[model samples]
Target: MQVKKCSLIALAISAAVSQMAVASQQSEAKGFVEGSKLKVLNRNMYMNRDFKHGQRNGTKSYGEEWAHGLITTYSSGFTQGTVGFGVDAFGLVGIKLDSGDGRNGVGTGLLEINDAGEAKDDQALAGAAAKLQISNTVLKYGNQMVSLPVLAISDSRLLPESVTGGLVTSNEIEGLTLNAGHFTALSNRNQSSRDSAGMKSLDLAGGTYKFSKDLIGSAYWAETEDYFRKYYGNLNYSMPLSDTQAFIVDFNMYDTKSDGLGLSRAWDGEKLDNQIYSLAAAFKTGAHTFTLSHQRVTGDGGYVYGPDGNSTMYTAHSMQVSDFNQENEKSWAARYDLNMAAFGVPGLTFMTRYIKGTDFNTTLSSNGKEWERDVEAKYVLQDGPAKDLSFRVRWGTRRTADIATGNMEDLRVFVEYPLNIL
Candidate 1:
């Protein structure tokens, strides 16, 4: 294995040198500026009780909040050359503010529970990366976070999502952009396990996010062995219908193929063809707005897959509504958001929504249905010691079939501060 790796490395080096010689390219750095930023974030969450198996069982079960983390980032602005050279540093530390026997994994981090077997809070972790910017483009490596609807970096928990690989973003064309990356390794949200490789995932493809003054769209493709290969796209439009109201419409689609490797063996490896499609629109006036969305999925039974290895159609059309988690399912979501800034509360907001899914297929029971409702509100301290600081509180209730994870309740409170490190 070592010999084969060496051979591959040698081949890559040879190819690189051949290109350098043929083009007679000269290497040099450009510019010379360095800067960094720091963010101290703390999320204190509590649960009134956990709901399970379609019932509010764990009624008397609740208590625990704590996951205070800090992130320090640094970046250098290119060095003179044909292709600019630079680097970025990402340092993270997660401090457990509170925990016990029942709340061990309450917050987030790449590591948890020391050898002592007890949940310990307040510690640290860090990483760095190298970057290069050339001709309206940049390439990054080391701990990275790639964001997309189909592949969004979930930093909603404790630590910001981190990955080890290469990523590139180019905006050579005006109003048009391109993003591509290959992430073969990841250190998910929390827990102290970094040696496991999620599998080699290669991603390529791009699209324009802004075509004119009001039209926008994007598309991409990604593949991870044993997981699935996915391609998805979305288009958004906005228009002013009157002085006080506007219109918004969005359309999206997704196509995926699975590879049986992990606990998620492609249910129907050979004959698997699943696609998700959805359309959503909204009307807004003053401090009030109404949203209506519709989503549909068609495919063999095992067409979608989510967290613990389950099929899902939530690539898009995912809101406070019941998370799209069933194949051959149709779902709908209606939500409302209000900004209280007009009432002298410039930093307060509220949101609520309901979603339902029908025509679910399962073996234990051929037909089933599911639904979810959520309500959330947020307030931000605009000035004084907590300037720009905000807090969000949300509660969600869900009900599903026996085969489903079933009745669920989630409540969370998060606060964060982004400090500039020049």
Candidate 2:
């Protein structure tokens, strides 16, 4: 039944594409077709995780995987009319190169597991969205990727996750942008199927305002039917101390509680109520930036988000492994960033950060403590046959005092090249 439903949707999308293609060829639609843009990205990724203690369900020590991906995107300009119409589409394909002995148990975001609990060799996913533009407002419907303070698409893997829904964005007011949306289904980055069962529809509304060049504020509210409701707000301010020196401050907060049918209460025997907050200060001089931050989670429940959703929390310590979002958890972090361009090495950059977390949930451990360290280096080609090519290396290590299977080290290498196809 699921396959049949997916097939029908695919057919409908194909028909729409055909009609749009024909319409675009007409003289009246020249502007829409000529203004279209198409891009293709080639990405290669390698991931390795070494467990220092405990073990996964089927793995003993480590897991490793490598894959290559191709991502194609097409964005069309609106038709030249009062109510302009356009279409956008994207296709993704991932080819598995290697899945070591622990692939069966490891959930790496690089590939989907088959029914028999083995990783698939390859996967393909695609989506299309229809858009309408009226003055300063735009409306979009169908499958697409969305980013907001309340809900953000996960794109830290072979392919980014997409949602099936409708969204409206308006920027009629100067220095302000408003967005509202409803999402009914989700397609994971590594899976081909769109799943909605057991998941309630998500509704979100948000707005961002720039009060001045150095200050900005944002607020958002979101609710998942029968699941939970969340509220978020953020403030940012920057002060220029000198020509080459500046100080910046950031504050972010989230308040959440169970709503509707109280699904969280029914599933976990506890209401979903939590407040999370983060505050950070940064000092910048020349090409170097230093930052110190703190985050805290209050209440009996942890911060709420989708099971496989990306981390949109405003915490500085949320790394690849853990979010440090357990009940009553508190974390602190220090970070350093350097732009090589200041040293005559343009297109190269380096960053390193470390975070320490403690005071976890009482149900788990009263004095749980964990820490993580991350280092990253990246370079982008400025010009040549491989112009715009990019390479990045990331390494992270985490240690836990009381949690089993939570201590591990991870490394990822990525090579990407983006090309304009049209």
Candidate 2, run of 10 with poorest lDDT: 21-30
Q: Number of clashes in every candidate structure?
A: 21, 0
Estimate candidate 2's alpha-carbon lDDT, on a 0 to 1 scale.
Answer: 0.78
The segments of candidate 1 whose C-alpha lies over 4 angstroms from its true place after superposition are 1-49, 53-65, 80-82, 101-124, 195-197, 260-272, 301-316, 319-322
Question: What tens digits encode model 2's per-residue C-alpha lDDT throughout 284-372?
Answer: 99999999999999875778666315645655556777777777889999999999999998899999999989988644477779888
Question: What do the candidate models score in CA lDDT, each in turn?
Answer: 0.61, 0.78
Give a tens-digit lDDT track for model 1, residues 147-258: 6545555565566656676666665556867666655566555543442335455444455579877799988765655666678888999998888789999888888766
TM-score of each: 0.81, 0.89
Can you give the lDDT of residue 270 in candidate 2? 85
Candidate 2: list runs displaced more than 4 Å. Answer: 1-30, 196-198, 261-269
TM-score of model 2 vs. true structure:
0.89
